[model samples]
Target: MDDPRDPRRDATSETAGNDDFGNEGLTSSDTLELEFREALNLANWTSGNRLQELGERLEREVELAARHESEMAPRVLDILRRNLASAEGASVESGVFQLKPEIVLNALRNVLFNGLVEASDGTRVTVATLPVTVVQIGVCLTSYSGDGDGGSIGHRLFRHDIMRRNSAAEQDVIDFLGRRRRRGMDTSAYGDDDQPMGISDMLCRALMIYGERAMLLERSERPWRLGHGGPMPHELIVGSGRKEMAFASLEMLRKLLLDHKRFIFVPSEISDQTVVTIANSLQPLQYAVLRDTTDIIENYVQGSSYERPHYKRSGLYQAVRSFQVDAGSKVLLCVYRASAIAPGRVFYAHEDHVHEAAQIVIADAALQESRGFPNLIDIADRTCRGMFEPGGLSAQVHATLARSGSPFRFLEERRTRP
Candidate 1:
């Protein structure tokens, strides 16, 4: 009736008729856009949850891989154990083993550098991944220290004996001794004019300082103690008279044992009669008589029956002969000494054992050296050939030289030409 084709009439009719439902089309489109945005947000939330789940799964897999690797560690160690057994001069008895020089040398290298586990102390074990040759040189150097002058000459000559020996360690020993000498002037307590301290006294001081330092470096490192949980046997060689020194040494040792509650002093010179007397006197600590002469050790081995608790043996002679050139005789003496000392524990007849125990040290040194390895084979050849000349300094130098062929030749040529 309002004439739909007429613009003014149509507008007026539309406005009046639909005023309550105005803009219904625009409202419907706005509702649809809001629904679409809500759907998008939900999808995004689902994707985030999936990503978090994936990340957690990857972390678990990594942990599992590490665990599997750790579990396989022991199996890998078994291979090294077999290789050690087959090495030359190794004796395996009931799965227990003993190593001769060459074998021992190799074993040390394997443990220190080659990644072989030598021994464990609950928390961690010492591994040898170092070259065997390098360990040999370290042993040689340690032995040289026993030859007097604190191994200064030997250290210099053997500087290049190992390919990876720790130069810093060598320098440390040098610097420490140098500083000690220097400080003597500042402090009258350790002056040269002071009467030389007894060996036992010196040992006590050394042990205290060494123990403290060792504890600081490695808190788990334990002190040497006896079966009753007392200190290890230590003696002080005092005075020129052997018997007097022995008696004083024993008395002081006993006192230390009593005071420390963990030490047993093995007298360096207790005879059969004295051994019995000392055993009777000392209630808690075990006793061992240290014989200076070979005859005394032989007498105890042959004469003493199983009735005596204290063992009698020659320690000084064994220490000396263990490093001698004549292997046949020296080896025999070492065995004899070991038999007399203890049937069970690993008795170190030669300084070689010490070298074997610390084989990694040499390898570490070699790594630090310019040439990069300890020349132990050369050292052995030179030692066997007696290429090392003899003099006070020469003996020390030769001992060091004997541990490395290249260094020995270089030093020898230098000496000859000079």
Candidate 2:
């Protein structure tokens, strides 16, 4: 028979012969079959080379994907973990209400006048509710050199509020301040004289006032271990128009509360609207407004009947300056036209709660004339609103006072109930 697997034959014939011989004894056809097999092996080798190239490419792609995932996974996990921790920390236990650190910090910086709480074991806690409040206050003061030109205290306050609300203005102030800093000149143009108060000085003063109040409130015996306790209900006083003198009074109050470590002094700024709102909001908490715009003795009327009486007298500022001397337990001194009555009034309401007071100040029409006055009000208002919502600083103060382990008794003496 002709060699079926002959290399000279058609390729189909070689395939047929290989299938037919299948392990039979070697013949002339077997030699031809071996050559055919060699050709088939060469073709398989070439195809395998192509597949190997494709496999290598696939392997490289897989390695790249794995590397990318490896790089990104930790970051994603960390974010998720932080979120979980925050959520967990914010959660309140049944029948137990606790303030969050952010809320506490905000109260310290803006409303509470920078109140701090140091634990008995020497853990110092600075309460700040919104990080932006710090940044906003910092930037607002940074624009001023404590000069009269930046505007009156009222104008400065107003500008601060307006700028805080207006994003464009804020950016401008920041940019202007940044450029001034780079140029090594004064950033704030408004001041009493050319020797404007630096923003850093203002910030330091504000922070010092806040820290002082916190230290006093916490009743720390040691200077280094200040702010170890919470607010004392009996020591709290909420009023309006006593801004500047309040800081000085706070010095006295610090002594009063600390000498009696169990006592807490809380000072608040309230407007006519705030008085009514707080009265309505904090139901069952005894409410009274001392219309002491005249002499300290004349303003002290007795009974709950003295709801919203107007005082026809000057020196209301003088009376407020001295009001702290007789303030017994929590007192809410609500004044009408606080800005009109005392334009540059400075008071403390837990540094964190200052944002609310700042809001009130900024909203006053009188502040419009003051440079930078309106800016902080809007910024503080937005921040306070965002943080406390339906319940603002008043709510926070009330809650803190309640938790302060002091007996809160509102006094309404018929002889001294203005």
Candidate 3:
């Protein structure tokens, strides 16, 4: 489709084997950046201009970390597979819960901060979902970057080749883009706009603006890596917020977000297919859905009755938004969509609503030690609802007593993948 609003899924490069619009052939120099900058300017969105500015700053990041290239998608999926696999490490058996706590911690942390992205509206150019948008932008740009030849990670990310192989990583980008998208609800804005961006279009916009920002953040701030699966390298603290207002550590942040039986974070990174593949590799964890909520520990205890109906059933057209299992040892997680707290309002709406949700897998941990329990509550403070990437690692995980000690193995599930 020639329309700028269209995703240009069929927009092949004029020259064979070129993906960066045509800048793939450009020599590595100021010339290449300028060429790409002009191409993004023609993207016909306000975010495009911001992307052009970002291109100037991102050159250094590309030069320094050229090590990360086309194989980006696999790294993300591999982490998911290993972390969630029941047979490999953790097993819920004989009613005793055991696991390598570090593995679970890493998986949860990686998904929470790294997987999210931010997107600026094409119409108003306002940034939305800060870290998540940048992550998506970086992933898309990396896909378009390709290898020296024509092949790119996009082939692996957006295409079905990986699934056809019947491999461990069960899903691809296109499937994720289709199934995991967060659409505009009728109750909110974008109700009557001539064109409201789909999940991919918003991703494309993020590809323009936040992609550049992520690259710049990588070089200037010097963020470290959780692992190869993460979207961008992150530093301890990157913003100008008070340390008192952030999460004490990754450990505490995990506890706060997953405090409930049902939650909805952004599962922007891991696909359900990957969860199934990991489930297959595991011996103990059973991947099953709630047919009628009989197995749940509790019913929808909170939220408005409209969204928190007593009955939920997965269907051909309508289905359970999550797949959950008791991973033994009292660890129960549901990658679910439910009426959650509102954002940017700065006030807890007495009424609850389950607006639009996909599966954002949350990390659940019931721990005995939390030194800064008073401080850890800052993460969900209703005062700063609009704050972007609210309370990042640097601010949240400071060097003070707020930081949690390395968790000892509460219980180790002694099982290897068969």
Q: Which candidate gets the maximum TM-score versus the true structure?
A: 1
What is candidate 3's lDDT per residue for 245-284, written digit by digit as tens?
A: 1112212222312232122222123333644332222211
Better of 1 and 3 by lDDT: 1
- What TM-score would each prediction reach against the true structure? 0.18, 0.17, 0.17
Residue-pair clashes per candidate: 38, 78, 23
Task: Give model 1's TM-score versus the native structure.
Answer: 0.18
Q: For residue 45, give model 3's deviation from the true position in Å.
A: 35
lDDT of 2 at 284: 15
Q: Weakest 10 consecutive residues, lDDT, candidate 3?
A: 342-351
> What C-alpha lDDT, on a 0 to 100 scale, does residue 36 get in candidate 3?
70
Top-lDDT candidate index: 2
Descending-lDDT candidate ranking: 2, 1, 3
- Model 1 lDDT per residue over 159-258, tens place: 1112333669977667555544543233211223443222223333323322322221223122221111111222222212232333443344333332
lDDT of each: 0.28, 0.30, 0.24
For residues 1-418, write the lDDT of model 2, one tens digit per residue: 1111122111111111112322467775886788688878665444754788868878987986556544543343333333422432121110111122233234334422322222111111122221111212111110111220111111111112122235587687786565445432333323324332223323333433343344333434322111212222211221112233334444555454434333222223333443333222211111112221222223332331123243213333344334433432222122112232222222222222222332332233233443212223333233323432333433453355457652143212442355
Residue 216 miss distance in model 1 (angstroms) = 25
